[model samples]
Target: MQENLPRKAACIGGGVIGAGWVARLLLAGVDVSVFDPAPDAERVVREVLANAEHATARLISAPLPPQGTLSFASSIEAAVEGADFIQESVPERLDLKRRILGAIDAAAPADALIGSSTSGLLPTDLQAEMSHPGRLFVAHPFNPVYLLPLVELVAGGRTAPESMERAVALYGAIGMKPVVIRREIEAFVGDRLLEALWREALWLVNDDVATTEEIDDIIRYSFGLRWAQMGLFETYRIAGGEPGMRHFLAQFGPALKWPWTKLMDVPDLDDAFIEKIASQSDEQAQGRGVRTLERIRDDNLVGIIRALAAEQGGKGWGAGALLREHEARLRAAAEPAPAGEPLRLMEGEVDAAWIDYNGHMTESRYLQVFGETTDALLARIGAGADYVAGGRSFYTVETHIRHLSETKQGEAFHTTTQILGTDAKRIRVMHRFHGGDGTLRATAEQMLLHVDMGAGRASRATPEVLEAIAAIAGPQRALPIPPEAGRGISDLR
Candidate 1:
């Protein structure tokens, strides 16, 4: 785990948001002690954690550290005793929240940081009754906190600047994007925008302009996609038609005063209105329970994030860029190779997208996985991104793959590489693909040629690279050659 990660953390509530906080912390390999008075608090947290693990297994391709331990404390004091980080997610009532924060402040270590998961409450008020108010701030996350990367960090009047800095690093290390609010204000940024939209949505439903499902369809099928990728200002900048933001504002500025939306009007949330909204939402859900709906939402969100991650030739955009950075850290933190075995270079599960019509792992993904293994080997031997940028890299010239067994979606897999032979400009290698249970699933034998990208011709590897390669190849020479190596189409036939 990285140094930015907390040694021990505590969650003071186990409702939806609190459980989500616990899930995110535990999955990032931070031990968590949770305190919530509800009899079902442990069960709720465990269930949410399970969902988080499932979604994360599909989303993060890099190897994760072993999961951290989780404990349920009998009281807030017990939970926060030695915790370095504490997050509170009790109910929305300001009085109740203040009392809880006060308790947490007194019970937690003097140096421990406390964060309140208050979506719209002012952090200044929440920290008012606290003894060490400097360490308190708001860390507002969206529903399913484990998946959503955006967390708004708002400092109160007394919040220490250093605490804010430390909070940024701590949350960022666990795969979150923590944006500091410029000033303390109710609702912060995201919720302010959402509140305006929600108000309009209510008016639409109240006046029977659109049903709940219809409103949802309008958003998800249109600007929601735009917001997912380019966001508001940038998307409208494109709508500006090359003149940029000024042109956009000039074009749409007049529309803002057109009395088109009842955004400022409040809808009566009387029982009748509540029933109307709930019934419409139920119809939209089609009888799915909350747990089922949560899974569905998580799966959809994963798909959206994954698609964004694949954009821009894989450099990623928006949240995808953040996901890529975290994955890079995970790769850097991967465990070192064992002393006497083939280099265990790559590991991943068969993604749902990798399944074929016959419900087995598709043929092309096998080649892709083997290709990634070869990339890992190159990265290990001093021929990584920087080396390629300097105009030299190894390109595979030939490959032979023999599929030995079946693989299904979500089945865990890994590849081990054995150096067959190596010289100045060429190397031959064998890659064995194995299932999670250690069954041999496939093997690929490949021949690669070192090339100068600028000259587009075979070239000797730099001495440093060759030395690293020799260090790996020399010890492995004592190992016997794999029987599957050097086989051809004729042999297979």
Candidate 2:
């Protein structure tokens, strides 16, 4: 686990959101102590935890740290005694929430942050009675807290800026994407947008325009897919086409006043209306359990995110990019010390998609990893994309891979690159792969020849390239040559 990730967290409620917080914290390798007086808290927490484990395993490809312990505390004081962070997810009632927040504040350590899972309550009112009110703020998370990465941090009038900073760091370390609300306003950002959409949805239903399912389909099939990667503004910026946002607004902004939307007020939730919505929802679900639906949602989300992640270079364009950044952070946190013997070149996990019928990483994935490591070495030796584009590059001539142990999905692996031998036109290197706990799993020996791609074949002796290789090979010469290096197919067999 990373240093910033909380080691001990106290969850002050055990309903959906509370249990979700527990699931997220525990899975992120944070020990959790939960305090909830409700009789069903134990059962509910265990169920959500169980569901979270499977969904989360599919969500992240990196090897997660061993899950931490969970304990049920009898009272708030018992739970918050030594907690690094405390989160309160009590009922929505303002008085009930204030009492719990105040209790958590009085019982928790001065340094332990106290966050409320209130979706809309003003942090100002919630923290008014707390002892250290500065530590109390709203950290509103979306439902199914184990899956959704967005946690809105709303700092109250008395809240310290450092408190929000710590809260942001803690959430981010747990693989969440957090956005700080500039103002401590009710409903935060996401929910406020959702509320408006919900109001319009209800109005549409009340006017007999669209069924619940119809409305859902309209979003999911079209703009919803686009929104998953690019939000409203960017999605419409493309709509602007050859022109930019200003032209887009000039063309479509007038529609805002067309009275086509029923968004100003919400439709009344009368008995007949409630039943109509409920019946439609039940019909849409078609007897599927919530757990079943959750699994379906997770699988779909995984596919969508993986597709976006494939887009590689971008600034906050998609969840896939965010997922990649998260994995990078996790790898950085879990990377082993270099020990000064070999240069660590690549550290990665067997992504879920790489596993094959044998339940181990596919052979192609091994080559992909080695290829990545070689690319890394090239980039390090001043032969990056720009350099390659200049017509000088190292082209791999041969590779010898020795598969010593089977690696499975979610298994963390790292490679150390050792320059076996180098000359002006050719460089030979051996890459060793080790499991997360330091077991050597595989090895690869590759021979690359420097080429002038614009001219036909082997040509080199470039001063800069030769110097960079010598810089790496010079020190590596002191390390004994690997046993796996220089072996042919006949010799190894």
Candidate 3:
């Protein structure tokens, strides 16, 4: 994954896919300029960004780069004027795309990478009209683009290999998995597979073999769950049993010759057939609006991705591995202490799962935040991985928490820590939790004792570690006392 990302981007066309690129770039701290002649373009982009805000906040633990400014330009030249990267997401019409891509190529700097979000169109055709055709390529991303991480990168005939390289790097830096289609074909890889399944599904419905809902249930209940983790090849390899893949394939491979699917033909979309399909689809969707359904899909995806991320720390799999790696990158790239300010050690918006019955962050999540804050502090003061590996570390022996305000899901929050006192055997620290507005949301005063893991007994920290702790503690000795620092339960004396 590329760690370096451009600070400015221009997007051509602000429809569904274009708006998605805008959200992704803006959230990643890239100032964006967008051009779309559609009347409702601004509203469409805003709504998608709102949804992106909610979903992206819940999807990860690390704070994102500061949001960048967004602007709509009247003309293509105005949009791509100083953009470091340009993306074209206009409709798939060949002529329209060729015109826009060519315009972007002319206006954007010679070095800026230009990407077209065309799923099936050849990059060669898309770039044919461009003066700098070598700088243009296809960068196809999945729907609800801000949430899904997959992007297919296809290089055109005249495309510079460096353009594809830069596209891969840019997509990876933004938390996407870029699959390179080294040899370009008509539909690329993923769409071809999806088309095959979709074609079979249509035949089944047309012949009254299965309803749309039934087909959905069949996939969801069976291969879908497996696909989320193990995926097709790995899941099948496991299912191959004690003798392994070759044995299983030998036994069942002949079934491919059976008349299991009508792959050669498509059901005509006549009025009756179209009505039948639309009716089934509407019944499946119920009464939910498009935005509402998109939110639902985003929520389900967030839950799945978070669950996979959790599994990554133990026995990792596909999506989980990607989630964990991306999170690690985010964490490593997070901002550090600014000048003399208390470290912005633990900062993240509340997760959707943290909300309780009262619609605020549950009481326990506050303590969880405090614990994460302490962990960050510990890492800073030489009690981190290496110290723990040496079989001695500090354990929270006592903690007092005061909740001054309720925190809600999607609210940006951070914690600042002050070292109250530290000696050879124990340390006392005070943590203040603040909302993005600087209102104190909670306070946690914790006392930690050094323990020898091998002996299971209290012990003094080594002089080196104690010196590191005191170096930080000494700087905060003059800080004013916090109001809730020494308070007891119910504010008892």
The Cα RMSD of model 3 versus the native structure comes to: 3.7
Best by lDDT: 1
| Cα lDDT computed for each candidate against the true fold | 0.90, 0.83, 0.84
Candidate 2 C-alpha lDDT tens digits along 33-131? 999999999998998898788676656645467788999999999999999899899999999988888888888888998889998999999987888
Runs in model 2 lying further than 4 Å from the true structure = 313-316, 335-493
Query: Alpha-carbon error at 224 in model 3, in Å?
Result: 2.2
What TM-score fits each model?
A: 0.93, 0.78, 0.86
Q: Which clashing pairs does model 1 show? A: none
The reply for model 1, stretches above 4 Å from the true place, is 378-393, 424-427, 460-475, 491-493
The alpha-carbon deviation from the true structure for residue 488 of candidate 1, after best TM-score superposition, in angstroms, is: 2.1
For model 1, how does the per-residue alpha-carbon lDDT over 1-493 read when each residue is reduced to its tens digit? Answer: 2888999999999999999999999989999999999999999999999889888877876778888899999999999988999999999999999999999999999999999999889988998899999999999999889999999999999999999999999999999999999999889999999999999999999999999999999999999999998989889889989898899999999999998988778799999999999999989999999889998888888888978876774557898878867876776777766544588777766778889999999889899889867877887798866788898999999999999999998788878988999999998999999998999999999998999999999999999999999988888888899999878776544
CA lDDT for candidate 3: 0.84
Tens-place lDDT per residue, model 3, 295-379, is 9988888888877865632223576567656665665677755433455676767877889999999879898789867766776
User: Least lDDT summed over 10 consecutive residues: which range in candidate 1?
Assistant: 332-341
Weakest 10 consecutive residues of candidate 3 by summed lDDT: 309-318
* Candidates ranked, most accurate by lDDT first: 1, 3, 2
Deviation of model 2 at 116, angstroms: 1.1
The 10-residue segment with the lowest total lDDT in model 2: 331-340
Quote the positional error of residue 379 for candidate 1 in Å. 4.2
